[model samples]
Target: FQFCSTRHELGSIILTTNLDFDKWPDVFGDARMTEALIDRLTHRADIHVMNGESYRFRQTLELRKRVAKEN
Candidate 1:
């Protein structure tokens, strides 16, 4: 958190998580800290809210079916 907040100008950080901002405190273990982190992270970010099953999850099921058929 300190690293990202202090040195954000150094580069970019990409984070992928299923949790939303309201639920971030569970991961950070501090509501205030999580709010601060969200503030800094979203200051100049292009956020994308993705829905539906993840591509990798869907692909894994397909791969398993293909292997079963081969067996």
Candidate 2:
């Protein structure tokens, strides 16, 4: 959390991670480290759980070009 810590003592910081906070232990390795790290993070922060596709699969530039050609 080098990046997050930089923002600490300043104001709120946002974590737009593909991995959930619950999975952070496995992601970071060492649950204790994860706990301590997240503890500092949660002291005054907003946690948003966002899940969705890759976006490219839903809408692509190739498809947009083809649609434009038809028009």
Candidate 3:
């Protein structure tokens, strides 16, 4: 929170999270602080939401198939 507060408009910040904004409070454990942090971070930010199958999951499935074939 301090970092974001300090750099709110002075620099650029790139953040990526699998969790949604609504779920952030669960991680931060403080609803007010979470809201304030998000507000500061997103005040002038461009947001993007990506939805697709995970690459790691696909690779894991392929590895399992290969192991099954070997057995």
lDDT winner? 3
Off by over 4 Å in 3: none
Weakest 10 consecutive residues of candidate 1 by summed lDDT: 4-13
Worst 10 residues of 2 by lDDT: 45-54
| Local accuracy of candidate 3 as per-residue lDDT tens digits, 1-71 | 99989998689899999999999999999999999999998988899998998999999999999999999
For lDDT, candidate 1 versus 2, the one ahead is 1
By descending lDDT, how would the candidates be arranged?
Answer: 3, 1, 2
For all predicted structures, in order, the TM-scores are: 0.82, 0.59, 0.87
> Which tens-of-lDDT digit does each residue in 2-21 have in candidate 2?
66666776777766777767
lDDT (Cα, tens digit) per residue for candidate 1, span 1-71 = 89879867677889888888899898889998888889888888889999999899999999999999999
In model 1, the runs with Cα more than 4 Å from the true position are none
Q: What TM value does model 1 have? A: 0.82
Q: Report the C-alpha displacement of residue 2, candidate 2, in angstroms.
A: 5.5
Total clashing pairs in model 2:
0
